[model samples]
Target: MDRAPTIKDVAERAGVHAATASRALNPATRAMVNARTAGRVHEAARALGYAPNSAARSLRTRTSSVAGVIIPDLRNPVFPPIVRGIEDALREAGYMALLGNTDGDPERERELVAAMRGRQTDGFILATSRRDDTVPGSPVPTVLVNRRIDGGGVPSVTADNAAGVHLLVRHLAGLGHTRIGHVAGPRSASTGWERYRAYLDAITSLGLDQAAKAVEFAEAFTEAAGHAATLDLFAANPGLTAVLAGNDLIALGCYSALAELGRTVPDEVSVTGFNDMPFVDRQRPPLTTVRIPHYEIGREAARLLLERIGSPEAPTKSVVLPVELMARASTGPAKPQDS
Candidate 1:
């Protein structure tokens, strides 16, 4: 190439004025241009391999043009779409995204938060909030995704856990499942704690509280924790007709435990899970789970953080997205033999 492509070059190629080209290339000002003209300018800029100098832009705008995204476990399969949503939203605002994984460790979370802030991130989008989360200290704007801290200090977007659990219990009851069990996640997490409470409320509301002998709590949301908890619950209440798992990973542990006892799912014991995570439908029998809008949750969190970054004095807001029941082959009517 003769010289690095410039805004003038982009304007010449796109047949628009330099001011119009600049507006099209800038995220904050792009909306002021006509859609057709903006599209043409962007296409021309891309064809010429053009990117504005970050040093110059930062000096002029006093912004890093980057956002940090923190997730608890990237291997969980539920975070890819959420991260994608965050990235899409950030890109449209002319900000690059940086990701940090905690692997479910508070110390790691603190280190990552500090590292991102050191890199001059304009804000944070966190997917690792716990019940009493205190890792991400008060600095730049932060938004919690897929998780939240009760009596919230930060903006967050999450699915309605209590309502989702109620839907699951009602479905199982409607199918005649009475001797129901629960494989709950760790109590330290807001999701784990809230979902477990929801399960209790659900059973009590239906007058099935007496049938709650087979409850177990996984130390974490991992498969191993679920497996151990399920086995423990089954040993105590061998005749349980159904189980409500804290999340899909824990439900998988339930599957492993039930398999060891030679129990066929939905025939002897029906299983239900939360989060309706990716590929549960492809399991031995499709899993019946509560569906939350993961991508939308991520997008909402990003928007909230952007809003907070723009206006630091805004009151903290919580966005509770709705959930739905996905009844699949994993649940069935309770057998008469259970009596």
Candidate 2:
């Protein structure tokens, strides 16, 4: 069997001391070696095909350079971009990401958290944090993304849902949408409550007490829930002329309900959604929504987690990313009453 290439082999080929070769290969020590000498050592390593054993290096450093990322659902379009951001950021930092999907179940989340902890992951980027969750007890550093925990001061990166909802409501009000309805997300999640409260605040601030009555809550962050909520809202208040959906999926549900009721978007009842997920623009009637930087939030969360892992004494932070309103085909001025 052929012996694996070694630093000595690289040094012999480059006509340099083995110690010099080792230093040249080490990222920390490379600057100490002359640039020309380092280049030569690199050439020799290439010729000898020397590859550092990451497993051995990790063992020696007592860190796996692996971060665990937990998501509530993989099927949610909002998560894919966020995961990409996390993976890209972690890869750039020479760390690996281990992804786990909890299907929005607390038990599954706890199980995944335990498995990740058992694997000796250096840290975690959790996108499934519930207000009552206990997963924050992990000894390793953790950063929440797109979610918040109650009383856990862990660092987090999340979209400003309240601000985004406020923007949406203000936009609707400016368009003369006095009879606006809201299809809120599940009450169990932070985004849900934050958005719901923001809706109330925005409506109240606009001095539209009647408009606030149009708000309804969905059972989950799914299209079915959105559809059911929209149906109930329409049944409860047949005069509503505009609807604010919790997310894009919920907005799609609104679309479904509108179709079943033979109502056209924008022309009959304008609808808006939050979280501008991919392909929303290409829908039959493009969704007007709040655009949260989902991917950037994930990337920033991973970056913060890595920083926390490196400097455990660093102060915890809560990063609130901004959101923008995307005016599209789904939202327009309210239809004329007589039309």
Candidate 3:
């Protein structure tokens, strides 16, 4: 087997001392060395396939060129784009991201964070923060994306969830859907809790408070949970003519449940989803949903994490972007069947 190239090899090839080659290869100390020397080191590195050992570099510079990205569920199409955005932004900044999935488990999340810490991640970009999370207590810098808890201790970048919920409810109300039910996600998640509360607020604001009896909570942000919660909602409120889903996955579950119950979307009941994920437009009825800037959320989260690492005392804040309502085939004017 071919031997792996080392810094010593780079130094010899570049005709410089090992320390000089190391400085030239590092982003921080590169400026300290002469530019011509740095250029020679770079040329030698490429020629020798000399990839610096990240662990060794971390020891010398007290900086790990690695960051951690925590995702909740990859099956949800919305997350892929968001993750891509983060990867793109981090790559441009010359940092590498290590990804972990928690599958909506707090214990799993904590374990993953601990493991990533053991690996010496400089910071964390967490998209899976539960409403009650110990992530705020992480020893390293942490930036939350897509979700946040109550305390403002950590930086966050989330979609305008409240606005999105309000828009979904308002659209259903405008369609004369007085008996509108909601398929809410798990209460443990801020996205579910906040959006569900907004759903209540929007319904009450429209004088549809009497119609809020159709609420059902999904066990998780998953199709199975969504289907189960939707079944319960329909059973409890058969008069419901419109349904607001916590997310696209839950919305899809609602679709499946409605199909088995022989109800046609936008005919007997109109269904609306949150987070206009990929391929929703190609569904049997083409979902009506609220579109959050998924990619921008990721980019903003990465940028915030980088900034917080640079300025640790910069007054932690949450940035909430706007949302847009997408009207489509899944929602329509209320049918008289509810009456």
Candidate 4:
């Protein structure tokens, strides 16, 4: 009664063997035990204030029960929900998340990965990976969230960027916007590249091939970058009636750039954005954008990473979740060229 409650104590209280109690207490092995018996074991452990010694289990299993989650930036407003989903999924499996922010720096990302590996993290869920990047010497499994490599070497969970972009472009074109411009995100990231490529493809398919010339690439997926790129895009093609921003942040920059040029949104220039992140709906004119399931992206990434961790030899897989178009006040019938 004086000493810490042991597995034996828990087992006796639950009328089960010590091994059964052990399996019941562990999330990984809980499925092997009977549901009723596992519940009783859990109840017994809780009643007796029993806590499993994770250190001992780690020593035996060679797994830290922790995952390294690396993201580009937390300020973007889209990543927080994804992170929350990852944490929720991991916690359900008796695992913890070790989070890091890379701020879109490759060197910083590598350093964080190394530090997390040094701490014996079981695997990694990266939201900062570039298209050409690789974890060459990584001994543990890694899954990509919201970003992916050029080829299919690692598992990933991403939204359907191409589909989302095509949807936005079609929506704009349907609004009588033939002269549409694009402010693309950095080309290095898959999200940026896919959306940009999709824009060209969509325009070409719609017989608006000349519209592709009115495009400018942002340095990063940030408001300032979007602002600069939008200005460049407009300077070259001032006749464009609609602007399809690479993402929500970029669309926000369009607002500032258009304002600076004295172009009233949806009157002179209708605008669309992607990743319907956070408060875009509350902007002076609510932004019309593609809605990706941010939280589900994180949860799916966690699921893929856990699958890889459990079965390291399993065939690598990727999940591309669907998206929806959220139409709002920011877009409307394009003004006539003379107007």
Best by lDDT: 4
Please give the RMSD to the true structure for each candidate, in Å.
Answer: 3.3, 4.9, 5.1, 2.7
- Per-residue CA lDDT of candidate 3, range 1-339, in tens? 199999899999999999999877765455578989989988999899877887777888788877799898877798999999888877644468999998867788888888988887878999888788766436688999998887658889999989999988888888888899999988988899999999998989999989766799999988888999999998889888999999999999999999989999989999999999999999989999999999999888888887676566779879999999999999989866563
lDDT accuracy of residue 113 in candidate 1? 86
Residue 121 of candidate 3: its Cα lDDT? Answer: 82
Q: Which sequence of candidate numbers ranks them by TM-score, best first?
A: 4, 1, 2, 3
| Runs with alpha carbons beyond 4 Å of true place in candidate 1 | 1-52
Better of 1 and 2 by lDDT: 1
**Per-residue accuracy of model 1 over 1-339 as CA lDDT, tens digit each:** 799999899999999999999877765466679999999998988899888766776787676878899999989978998999899888766678999999999899989989988888888998888877663757788888888886677888989999999999999999988888999988988889999899999999999988755689999888899999999999999879999999999998899889998998989889999998999989888999999998988888888877777677879999999999999999998887763
User: Worst lDDT window (10 residues) for model 4?
Assistant: 130-139
Candidate 2: segments with Cα more than 4 A from true spot: 1-52, 135-137
lDDT of each: 0.87, 0.85, 0.87, 0.90
TM-score of each: 0.87, 0.84, 0.84, 0.91
Per-residue lDDT of 24-102 in model 4, one digit per residue for the tens?
A: 7765566679999999998898899887888988988788889999999989999999999999988766689999998
Best by TM-score: 4
Question: Predictions ranked by lDDT, top down?
Answer: 4, 1, 3, 2
Worst 10 residues of 1 by lDDT: 23-32
Select the stronger candidate by TM-score from 2 and 4.
4
Off by over 4 Å in 3: 1-57, 336-339
lDDT of 2 by residue, 227-280 (tens): 999999998988888899989999999999988888889888889999999999
